[model samples]
Target: MSRHLRLALVQASAQSFEDFAQGLRSLMKSPNAAELVIYPELHLCSLGAETMSEREYYTAYAEPLDGPRGMALAGLARELGIWLIPGTVLERGADGAVHNTAVVYNPQGELVADYRKIFTWRPYEPMCPGRRFVVFDMPGTGRVGLSICYDAWYPEVTRHLAWMGAELVVNLVQTSTSGRAQEIPLNQANAIVNQIWVASVNGAAPTAQGHSLLVDPEGGIRVAAGMEDTTLLGVIDFDRVAATRKFGTSGDSWPWDQFRADDSPLELPLYNGHIDPATWRPAISPETRNDLRPAGPVVFCRPAGENGPQ
Candidate 1:
């Protein structure tokens, strides 16, 4: 197959957890077609200047790993017969802690993988990190992995997934064009180093400056949109991913380590272990990397004795 699988990246502004799920179901009926559909990070809520209590309204929409929304997504996956990568959200536990989580559902309506956000940002404290990475098989194609928005910035996360036989890496992003332009390159490079397809979908319009992009393992931009409020549809060749992984004439050929995924069985229990939410972090750095870049806006910090708005 040569770049035949269609992909859809939804970039609309986020709503509540309930509305978000409903919205996802609605997108499936969109005029565009995709074998795989990806929602942006925090696909459940929008960012506002509001305080934590107000933000809690959004997080309250959070659920456990085995909650109703999870089942609903699984049903949607089954109904559409498409692989879906939902973004991170606040998953509350019985211990009164919340976690930033990413859940994947297969066409069969089963929970293929659920990855807790390893690297979270502010307002996402007391969440936990998933100890390991997860990869699953695509019906007629190769395997794929998932990551949250912040997780995209971390090299190890991408490296881990790439090493684990992932032909495709889907990153759900909820980024703001506040102070950085690192979004595209960071996700694209991850694909290059690992030789796989990388898909990143971010929010659009009043919520963000849209820049959703799809990149091939060779660092090629399959499709991209820079306009605000724009959404994009593209195709990726799953077969090429396998061919690219092969090591030419040398026995030491393929750069990918097949052993990385030898034991990553999706049925294994989540490593939620002794790890505490208060210590969890997003898979990537939430801070914008353009603090010193003259092309972007400058970030001014409050001093020890600022009296303007303290």
Candidate 2:
């Protein structure tokens, strides 16, 4: 059996929710329809700074788990006979808080998982933060991890999912043109450090950077999209993930094992939890490793004897 699984990354525009559905449908028309398709964060809504003041606009877009957009994405998965992650949408929580949630659908058109985004960057976006990360089983692929936009910024989120035995991390993002340069490299770095495959999908340019990228366990870009509305296809070889983890960057047997042996650096009780820190014991003889290095920018001299930004 082939260990390679095909995936489709839909670089959609910030049109209406219905328009996003149509874009996905058009992408799946090809004979190469993948076993899995992913979309960007806030795929169903606009992320322009002006939208923040329009409370009624969000009120109209926010829907329950079984809303119209959800139904459309679920139906598409069933019609295409593929698994789907319909990006992050505005969801109205039972507690009256609005959540930025990523919904997953199985081939059977059933909602398998609904992951609320945990790391919401305040001032950038206004939404309730999710408390935990979610990992689910993908039939052909191994365990899959799901995160949205800002969540990928924090390494702890990916590390937690990696420790939970996730083989793939799918990040749904919505970034501006200026942010893509930084976010793309950050995503690649996370995949390499975790020794797992990563698939990042984002909306098109103007509103988003639209540089959707798929990175292998070794931090190789398998497929990437430009700044436009289009669908990108890529394949992931499960064997590569297994091989990379077994023989990590420096021939180390699973890097996470040796690196994560001590979680003392993460003060759980003090950071988020309400527990008293005085009861906790400090880590003894912690290993110190410096991975930082200085990097110089590439400068291109123009024909006119002028330098350009790297």
Candidate 3:
């Protein structure tokens, strides 16, 4: 049987945490409010300075997983009778390292998943990386996966969730004002290749791009919001995911049922079936290919024992 989820993406433009909270309360009262509500990334960081460097900003605002901010969000979930993904906040771990963490709350207001983001856009982000990937089943919704902002650039994250049976991948983002071109396309491509619905919510201007979007399994833009302060709502159909994977006769499929017995678990059937095992060798080279030329001017480093560059 196919499943459907009604979702709302709140594209925020609030300049302060208090303003964000106030606006959120009003949005919930909309006649179109959905069963699942999601907000853009780092909405809580509004209380801090916009001029602060990434390091300064994150460190100052970091809070514990069950801190006041989290409690407030969880309470809202229960009060509204909705499953909530209130985007991410800075989590100050027991070891004192700050992580970009997203928390999931079921309708009962129980924390279902506390996912610290696995990939931080480093050299620029200055946040600690997470070690775990989180996927959980919602009561009426199919399995749900969580990722935040930069994590959407890495297909492996989404693929891991899909493999774990997630029909929907939710990415809460604070898009770079200068990088929206790349950000939008990468997420759309990820949804197409993985054949899963993606709810990509983004922070609003005058600091970040606010093109919060909902993508269907076929990579269609079901709903998209401009760089404005508004909520975008859409319905996600799990039936589309099932339809995408259906292939061949006897109910065999592309992804959901592709990892059949007698197939090499590590390799997809498309590639494994085309190769002759007896004659195969690893296709990868042990070292970088000498034929490839560096795109920029190169500087040569000599071996310790050698007098000149090799």
Candidate 4:
């Protein structure tokens, strides 16, 4: 059996934490078929730590996967009976290190997954990468995985998600203006290679650009909204994901399933598969292969590829 998921990507202003909460609560009240709702990265603040000290943002907005923001989102997801990816927040780990993290909540309001930004998009210095990657069952569909604003740039994340049986790759983003040409193709290529759906919700209005998009199986932009606030509802078919098998036999086959598991439990399967010349083309890698600053997800993730400062 396959599931068709209705995803709602929230793109609105972040006047304050209270404003964000109120907006989310009100939006969730609307009647829709959305099984899961994703908020933009750092949607809790307009300019996170820009004016306030990093210490202040950590104290005020940073919370554990068990803290206030996580708890509140948990209750909301349970109350509304919808899965929720509340996006990323700066969390202060016990070791005094800060991490940009995301939480996944089931409809029962139970926290099912927690993904720290494996590829942090920091301005001052590099933040430590999270330990690993993980994928979990998304109710009726195959699986769902988390990648934050910058983490989505890596093909490894989406490929790992698909290899782990994720039918949909959900990205919560807070993209600034003028980085579209780079990241758009990265997202589409990730979807096409891994054979799944990718829905990214971005911030809009007040300061940044809002570009919430839904990409389908054929690597086509099924629905898209520009740098303006608007919610789109799209169909994510599990069957499409299941049909992406490359080998001649579909049942007992996966193109990259045989990838050796690594000790980095968070490691996503890296693909070296040859592209089908008849139907596919290679993605531009000049930008993605280098340590480019926040150009897009792929380019953004190159820093991680080097595993050091740029």
Say which candidate scores most in TM-score: 2
TM-score of each: 0.72, 0.79, 0.78, 0.75
Give the per-residue lDDT digits (tens) of candidate 4, residues 179-277: 654677778877776767888878886455776788876678998877777777777776665445433123454444433233223322454454332
Cα deviation in Å at residue 126, candidate 1? 5.2
The candidate with the higher TM-score, 1 or 3, is: 3
Which lDDT values do the candidates have, in the order given? 0.64, 0.72, 0.70, 0.64
The digit string of per-residue lDDT tens for model 3 on 205-256 reads 7767888888877678889988877888898876566556443122342433
True-structure lDDT of candidate 2: 0.72
Identify the superior model by lDDT, candidate 1 or candidate 3: 3
Question: What are the per-model C-alpha RMSD values against the true structure?
Answer: 15.0, 12.9, 13.9, 11.0
The better candidate by TM-score, 2 or 3, is: 2
Q: What is the RMSD, in Å, between candidate 3 and the native fold over all Cα? A: 13.9
Q: Residue by residue across 1-310, what tens digits does model 1's lDDT show?
A: 2335787887767766577667666667776657778777776644542445744754556677678877777887898888877666667777756667777777898887767777775464445665667666565455667777778888878876654556678887777766227878898788877777898888776676668899986778888877465557887776555445443212344443333323333332454443222221112111212231223122232221121111
What is the TM-score ranking, best to worst?
Answer: 2, 3, 4, 1
